[model samples]
Target: MGKIASAHAYANNEVAYLAWDIDGKIEGCLGFEVVRIYLEPDGSVSLRDDGEEDRVPCAAWVGFKGQRNPHWLPQTTSIWPVQKLSWRDLTLRKRRNRAQLRPSEISVRYEIRPLGDWRPGLEPAPDPVPETVAVAKRGADGRPVLDADDRSVKIEAKAYDGKPRPLGYLGPAVATNAIRVTRWIGPFQSTFTNGVLAAQWLRNVIWEDGVKRPNELMGMISDPKNGIRKYLAGDVLPMLRELFEQAGSFLLALYELDDNELVDLLLANKNRIRLILANTGLVEGEWDVRNSHARQALIDANVDIQHRMFNNSTHIGHNKFVVHLDDDDAPVAVFTGSTNWTTTGLAGQTNNAIIIEDRNVAKAFADCWHRMLNDPLDLPTEFDDGMPDNQQGAPFRTSNETPARFTLDNGAKLEVWFSPNMPARRKSSAIPPDLREIYRLMRKAEQAILFLAFYPGQSGKDCIVGEAIEIGRTDQRLIVSGAVSSAQAMPNYVPGRKNDRNDPEDDEEAVSPHTFTEANVSIVRASRLDDRDLLSDFGGEELTAKGGIGAIIHDKVVVIDPLSDDCAVIFGSHNLGFKASYSNDENLVIVRGDKALAAAYAVHVLDVYDHYRFRAIEAELRRQGKKGWSGFLATEDTWLDPYADGAKGALMRYFARG
Candidate 1:
């Protein structure tokens, strides 16, 4: 007989996306129950040290807004089925003490079981199966073991505590393929920060005895602990420290270098580090004023350093990258991304960093570093113009040189490009090739185009935001969603891109800076419900919006057709704008045909988008003196009815199936 259901799991570092589908319709189907099994070192799905099966906990408690008898209670996935077709297990652990599992030390797989026979009023469904299953053989510690060898053993039969059974009833459990989830894929290690300091978790950390402790939060940023930093600065800092322990010389380029911890790191390893620091471009003052501490420290430590002021020029040195060379001075690996070497860049802003261990990628970056070292004042004008040995040129400036494509072991195509493609003295009217390629990808997107930007240039000819808007206006069926921290990144407020225009084909109609709910194109600004909004529904908890920390949506990422084979993700320190392309020293990498990586980025965009969409709407409602978020959950199951039709259902199905 055919299996009743099948499940799939995609994991990256700390989070796993779980999706399941039914083979056929079930009578009185309620939802699906999910259970995660932590395998032993030998791949045995054994009971945990606490004698409890490794079942994932529900992050949210499902309950009615006001009910005399509430069904919501703290429970595992085995007890309360997930109401959605897919769920994300953010807290993947192995033990009862709640210690996070290291990806290398553990292996995990999931089992999905369909739950049916729902009673009216959505009362808890009866126990679908036994609370715990009996193991045929077990050790004194309660973990399953082989009868002879005393080694941890695998259970072939499906049970609540052991391996899944092949045969079962109508709601048979379907197991997903196991995965050793890690942030490191092949020679690449990608890391992102929690960066949302305004989140409730931070509030919990800072609040003690009815007082908010900002100092405690600051301490956490400086010295991350308990995974609270969420690999933001934590992962990058450790990687740098690892390099210092190795026998390698380093090549460093940074825009801002004021973080105390990072400066200490550089100082400790100054003997082997060749540094190129830049001005923040905030003020035209003494070249070394902003980064004086780090620069002065490195200088005192006798490190080989060059400070690039980029003075008198409109462009600022905006690169934040590091390259490592072996003892023989051969390029080994390179770390490059949007993150700057500053406290705010690390712990405050939403940023990303990637460490690529490929020698070819490292060599390419190293060649650019050498070119910059040769000409600290002005970037070289040509790479192969037969210039004298003293006049080396920039490798990434010419179209023939850059948009360099590299193929990874997994068949993902990577294209790297550095900026300042145009001449230094002249302002070109033609669109830069780097940005035109991005616009082309957006226009040709078959399914969806999603992006998150700090400020991808104001709405104009060279603006990536404007290009996305124009594409949305032309093709109403294409899904365009994005989040931006700056208000200028979006257009003026309009009800709808298509409906507001007197003629549907009009090219000059103002696009909405706010959400375009009807046009299949939605853009939201980074905002939250502040003191002005009523929160009585949430136990009178206040959500205060603290400003000036840093950019909340600092990521410069664009995902085109994420679920398709032709998926492309354009991301890096490049602002994805004209100025970044024609002036600033920046890096951009385009990754294509890596569905897993594309989906990771797609989920990140959607996560940030959904978080702020409500806040953006609430802020607008507050502006209009209207009520927002009545602080109530749906009293009836009819709330799910909205997902049966319309754009909502379409979106739900699109992501669920993927």
Candidate 2:
């Protein structure tokens, strides 16, 4: 016999040693065997047979651990016959027959009642096992298992309520065990990268559109309630703050918002006073309160507040107010933006702005500002000047002659002065000596020519002169004119039709030829001077000519020899019309020698003209063709470049015919 194993248990006041071989052979069998039970903290009861120091087959009962008495020993001899059992087989049988056994141990011949589905009446029944064993139950409330792993005899688990719990319980200790599992599963890396890309894209689109809205998709994502709140509040906000602070005066203008939003913004930034001026029509009705509030805030802050009203018909004149600061002899700054100071212009509409730090540019804008503020040409009738009726007709006076003339830090001086009545001189040949100086300068230019006017043909004589100069120039002659028009002049209309011969003569036709008068001859003259082809159909039968009243050319500029190293002429507002040159209180400042400044003025003039022409062609094509010609016309391309492609080429071809 290799090593006999014997189990002894106290039962019926008798001690018996049941002997079995290592191979599970019943070498010898004695009386009752003694089996001692040791309870474990894991809710398991271990059974050890005496006389087996190696504990060759120590077994532990796992399921339903509680105080109970052993049942099998009492009827040990009642079975068919004694049968030996291996240690492995004993453990396996205990696990399989967990429901049939009590939370106790016993030693007996294995053939007794065949453990499967056999209830040992002598032993107390084992309690029912928990359906779901919480390996690590957390919190005092509901059970939430974080994770679980099952391996036939063993299980691992974990749970998280407010805090994490890492502990577990064992089951079927004789063959099965339990363990606690832990892991980390969250998509942090991917989410962070995606969020960064989204933020960048949002910034670009917002800047391009010049609009901002709280309800937009990106705005929602940046809201405090969203999961990305931390990102917006912490990283994004801080980054924007740094960028805005560093931006100084270069920051572009933001689009306007609704009145409610404007109020909210003002409240949020109560320490800072905001100034706004806009056309009333562009704003919502509710903005009146906001505008009033803004004006009051500026007054309280001891800052100057200026409001200029304009109608929708004067879009170019409406938003032309510019601000210049410091350097009385030289303007150091210029402010231009889409913000109209009205509730709607500042908050609702998308606008863009630029602030030029150059002194010359600033001075030019300041001059424009003073002219608009002082000139009574089109101001509201209710304006008060604190002057008596006798002196009301006198020239306006201000504390300063005008905003400071511009002189650059780089030794360049900008001469911006008023030439009252040059337009009148240009429109009508009633030129005084001073007014004639403007025309004389235009005649003196040598290399290049540049003209910026709102309505090119409003001054008939200026049109003729400009056409003559264009024909005379050996170099490029750039003409910039406004395209915004209220005139309903018919296209391709043949003039010269006095009346319809076939129809009966009406009362209008019955009037004498001497009683009839041309409504806008100046406009016609200007058009003819620019495009000589218009003069060809001057007196045809199909012409339908009309005039624009209260139509004003707001721009005042004329640059000659702009690209050359020699001379240039800049004059305007007093158009080439007779009234502008003689009667109107107009002014024009002529710069004779500075080629560099003249070139800059020329460039600016050309830019406005190119934009006007592009928009005009687009609008006209849309109106006349009605065949979706707008799309082709609206495409943007460099006007200064060769006109050999697309609509630009078409435009060049059309002009070339003239």
> Which candidate comes out best when scored by lDDT?
1
Q: Write the per-residue lDDT of candidate 1 for residues 6-85, one digit (tens) a residue.
A: 56666655456776554334444444567777877677776867987675534433322332111112234444345555
Model 2 ranges off by over 4 Å: 1-303, 306-413, 419-438, 456-557, 567-658
**Tens-digit lDDT string for candidate 2 (1-658):** 2122222111110111122222121112211111223333454453446533222223222111121111101111111112222111222111222212122123232111111111333331122222223332322321222333421222333211112111111111121111111010010000000111111222322322223344443343323344332322222222223322321222111112223333343444333322333323333322223234544554465543244333222221233223334423345554442233222232121112223456566556555555444543343442222111211012432321242344445444333433232222123434444445555655565433445343333322334233434334433233222221212221122224345656645213221110101211111111111111121211111000111212222234566654454555454233333333333333334445554444334433433343334334433434354332211111112221232222222212212121
lDDT of 1 at 254: 86
Candidate 2 matches the true fold with a TM-score of 0.33
State in Å the error of residue 318, model 1: 1.2
Query: Each model's RMSD to truth, in Å?
Result: 11.7, 36.7
lDDT of each: 0.63, 0.29
